[model samples]
Target: MMFKTDKQTLTDLNVLDWNSASLLRFFDHTLTLGGRDQLYNYLMHPLTTIEEIVERQETIAYLSTVNVSKLFDKYMMVDLERYLNKPAAPSVKNRTSYFLDTISFNFFSLSAQREQLLVRQSVREIAMLFTALQDIVAEAKSSGKAVGLLRIYADFFSANASVFDKEEMRQVGRGKSWRLTTHKYNYLFRGKRRPQVQELFNMIYTLDALTAVAKMWNEGGLCFPRVNTNDTAAALLRIEGLYNLALDNPVKNDIHIPSAQNIWFLTGANMTGKSTLLKSIGICIHLAHVGFPVPAQSMETILFKGLMTSINLLDNIGSGYSHFYAEVMRLKTMGEIMTVDNPVVIMLDEIFKGTNYQDAYEATLNFINSISGIESSLFFVSTHITDLGEIVGMDSCVALKHLETKADPKQGAIFTYKLLDGIATEKLGMWFLNRESVFETFRAVQPRKSSS
Candidate 1:
């Protein structure tokens, strides 16, 4: 099964983008371009099955315990990749053919000699890379850590045993007999064993990507989430100490969403961390689906078919849709998605904020009531309209939650950035306005009279 998610959801969670603080950027420590591309592919298409996710998690966990830094270098890998991708030259038949070609290339054709030189350099790099991988495999086997993905890689080396022979590679490294040996190995690698060489390159790139993720796991102290496979019971997502990875020092919050109480009616004062909380939850869910370690102490969740978020939704000016209309369309999209039987996670940060208070309140209230009946999915709808809390509070399926904030005489509104039960009653919009002296600024700036 493929995991479902749209561009808007990814953008809302900052999962992948050109931004420096994107989740992809945070985990992208790859050395080679191939490794980076593989990492990008992994983030773009998250795994759906529990078995696949667990296997990837195990691979990353195993990698975290090993030293992969010595196996690859950026420049050497780049050169080897380039050389392998280039078209192979015509094969030399025998010693006579190689001798003639070498004489002709050296004396008559500068380009041919340069090409041969480049081929020799590429061969040398490949030999070095094979030697490095062989050493790593030897160490892993000696230490009895060659299992799982490592074992698979080791088996590949074994299958191509002649290609990574210790004495032969050492000979290739020393440049003992350049003309015959270089052309021979080059033909063997780039011509006869092209497919195997390509496969080896792919494996190394994948290992590089996984090793980067493992490094992130070690540095960030991230943990692999427990994917609950019990389908007999209701779906649940329980995350403890969840925080946004984009923030340097983010305040952690715990979240619980059971199928029994699927809808979370979130309310809070402006800028009190409601949107941040929603983004953090969305990011964790996304990372968990990708089989990457999440920025949380612990997490347990049933597999979800999709995850959608409308945190920073924008209006379609070119399409002639107002902000309110766009918001309605987004919700309509979510409603259609919820029609499916599979479970999903939907997050709407400050829904209906583009419209007037009365319309927003009525729409939010009705929407909450409608989605609350969706027991298959989880809903997190945040709103500035605290009045709807009273009506939604009555629904047993809706969990009333808010980011806690306190008012201080000296400090004004003190944002705790903490998630707590119950709705926020304080209206701090006017307090913020007064604090910023907006009214005073307006009064101070009088309209200029036209000179007649």
Candidate 2:
């Protein structure tokens, strides 16, 4: 089974985008276009099984210790890929046909001659790429790190070793005896061994993607998460020192949501890092499913069937829906998912914020009450209405938590940005208004007695 996610969840977490600041851009250090595409595919489809996820994690962990990037050149790989994908030309039957074809190309057709030259360049590129892979395999074996995906690649290269003979490739690359050996080798490569060559390039591209992920792991100081495929009733998510990667200096927070307390009713004031914390959790969950290292010191989680996040949701103007309606629809979708998929992670930031205060409070309270019965799924609901916390706090399944904020005489409100136990009682809305001088500015302007 594939891990379940949607565009809204992906957009909420900034998972895949062309923007430089996106998570995809942050981890994409692949050397070739095909490699980048492979990386994108990895991000798009996260694994559902713990075994598959662990295997990928081990492969990347091994890659992080080695310098495989030094063996590949982006341009050369790109050229080789283009050459392999090109349509193969008719092969000459014998030496007589080869000689005549060469004569015809050289004398009559400039385009044919140019094509032959390009083919020779492509042959050299392929040979160089194969040699690089050979070295990589040798390095992996000598280091005793050739296992999992690396071992598979090594085995493939070993099985096809005769085809990519170093001496023959070297001679063919040097254009030695073009009339005889070049045509024979070209026929062997482009005609007879095309499928194998394509398979080799696919492996190279996969390596490039994994190498990029490994680089991210090493550079970001990320840790591989321990994923368990237990019953949904035993779902658990615990992470220590977890923070958002986009921030230069993010405040790390510890989160622990055991199966008993499946829902966390979060309360915090505005700008108290609630949204950032939610995004960080969602990002880590998604990365864990991808078998990629998460931006955390350590983590242990059960394999979740699905993930959904409702943050920064917009109104569907074309569909004649207001923001509140959109929020309701999103919640409906999440509810539908929860019905079939147990152990799904659902995150809602400031639920029903687009509605009136009374309606928001009632809706939030009722929603929490409704979802608290679903003990298998995990829910993180952050809201400004701390009153609901007092009600939901009594529930055995609801964990009441908040981002701590302290009041300062000089600074007005100093946000600690720390996750703390208990409901938040602080209300700093008026303080924010005064600190920004919003009322004072209005008083000073006074609308200039517009009646005159």
Candidate 3:
């Protein structure tokens, strides 16, 4: 029951790439290697259960309410990870080796001092982090919500509060000299205390990742989606005020696909926001599955097994796949996936665009005909083939919709970016070409007939 999505779908949704337009880039606020890795892990694999998703959302919500800015020093935690990952010589407790090690330390005083400082920094950060964990626990208890993750960390902290509260640690930061602080940390971290330090480091990594999620949720004013996992097959998706998170002033629109209608046939002229709408839906599904707040005023949808999208298809030069062949292969892959029993949400933009109009129209119509019967999943297909809507609209399972546009005569076409029922019959392509004087330019570039 693992929540799944492919690399192509991720790219289509603009999720993971480091480009400024990626969804991950917009939400990533991690300051350490561990935190960044953790965030990436979550994005790659979303939780599959209702309870886990809600628990995670509650944990993020509670965290967003608290300002734990001083809990962990970003630089110190990064250096701590670096030090821990650094290769180390195996300890040799024999008397001969001990004496040799002591002599080696004398020769490498500068290196020893640097190592001591690293250890001191680690101890200070861990201590501050432990205190921060306790504060979160208090907040969780006060919130009266089921903050399962935070409570687990709080319990672990409570069980080991003694080691952190020890007199040696109390003197760690109070000492005036770096050598003295380092010696105290070294003494306190010996034996069982070493494992305690490791556990605290792990907690810091988890908290940092959570903190990044919470910060984004708060800043974006994102709301937790009402995920309906009860219907495992053919569930509905209703999102109000949905918009692209990457855009500065995006036009929000509502979308709804009742259980009776699973396939959405969207039609609109270019720049009418059809692709953006598809992307927004995909992003919302992904973020909701990740247990983070979504970029919408409200969202309620069925828990899909996975999301599959084909928006940005490209030719495979190395594989010798033409653009049309590549698109066909991608659709073939989706067809194969649909055969499986698990439910999935499928999205395709301008399918079969690489081929001629006759073939593209026929192929797209056949494709819609084949998938319209799938009752265990949802389908969203955006295309300029408005005729397909007429044919597909006859099906009870298909919903025909369009993003409407208006011609301003003087200002040209004014795009509303609003979703509406019924198919689009507007033929604005020629209008746009005429407005741009494309035919005049072509005429000017032609050879003169007078020469003949």
Candidate 4:
């Protein structure tokens, strides 16, 4: 993830903008609320699909907003399915079943073949039992009778409750011809498939675990981890402050940072808060969605999975890799984790800042197009490249405000660092032109490449 550009606060949100002052407190709050070890699963959930690099950047920017130690309570669809004990997408069924098998096997004492069969059988029995119970429920409801738990089980099968009909639910399975049950027949052969008297015990146990898993999801996602943030209210308040900024700032030409979604193609003068704006919005969102207060006195938003970045990883000692090459690889890695359907907050600072103009422009174009379709928490990017802004269409731009500077024509160019309206035509940083003599400097002499 790219770091933030903090001109004001030196806290943790300023990794270009992480303000560390309230960082620990923020994490403590998350931990307090999200529960134990749930943080690990929360972090890994985003890896399910990184649709593009741009979302990854925004994702990082969003991360700078939250307390890592504290847990955010938002749940993704897949997580919801798992928690509800519904099937995940068909693409992931085999994996889910494998995981289920492992859990069931480890928690029980069956041999490998036995384990597989037992799970299958249990699932079949459960399904049959479900249908039978439904039928019984209907009959009782239609008649003048109201069936209690035990009475229903006893009515459906001979073996039911003196206390509760719970045991009877299992006994009915013994009467079911294994050959007739196609759904869970394997389980019977896998384990002891005799008609046990305490059928309700097994039924209740399996049903309870299954139901709990849907609420909690797997060992990780099925259920929410505990939240342990030390101070939820304080962290929420800081978040509120950013909302205040968002509500306060309205237009780029006028410079009000409005609510926006993923992969923004930003271009502006150096001091326009392009970078700072990115963090401000990021902080605001992290605060608002996590149920913390926003920067603004009032806040509004939907919760997100997590945040990621690809902004500052650029300042490597010449990248030790080709600019376009590295950019491509980084984006590929990001796409693996960023999902288009879910929200990811990304921030890119002068992406391709190291590549030739042509390649940089092309890469940026592709990046923007890729994430334009995904939902997001925030997407902030900064650049001096005008074509990117123009080609992208500024009116549709997310963070396109410029830092309009007034030149003191008489006393050299003094930078105010104050942001202004409209896109900037000239950034005063030009004086540093020859800082790294790119043969654009004195002498048309090309760097002498050695001949073999």
Give lDDT tens digits, candidate 3, residues 229-348: 645523478888998988888899888888888889899998898998999999999988889889999888777788889898899999999999999898788778766635788889
Candidate 4, residue 410: lDDT? 67
Cα lDDT tens digits for candidate 1, 56-156: 89889888887877656788777787888787645766545654665664454778767777788888777766767777777887888775567777888
Q: Rank the candidates by TM-score, best first.
A: 2, 1, 3, 4
Score candidate 4 by lDDT.
0.41
Q: Compared to the true structure, candidate 2 yields what TM-score?
A: 0.91
Whole-structure CA lDDT of model 1: 0.83
Off by over 4 Å in 2: 91-103, 107-109, 158-167, 170-179, 231-235, 446-452
lDDT (Cα, 0-100) at 305 in candidate 4:
46
RMSD of each: 2.8, 2.7, 3.5, 16.9
TM accuracy, model 4: 0.40
**Tens digit of per-residue lDDT, candidate 2, span 1-452:** 66779999999999898887688999999988888989999999999888788878988988888777754678877777777767764676754565466556545487887777777787766666677677787788888888768787888888988776777776665556454566665666677688887887888888889999998888866999998766642348989999988888889999888788989989999999999999999999999999999999999898889999999899998999999999999999988887778779999999999999999999998998888778667899999998887788899999999999988777778888899999998998998898789988888874655684
Model 2 score (lDDT): 0.84
Off by over 4 Å in 1: 91-108, 138-144, 162-167, 173-179, 230-235, 447-452
> Which pairs clash in model 3?
none
Question: Whose TM-score is greatest here?
Answer: 2
* Candidate order (lDDT): 2, 1, 3, 4
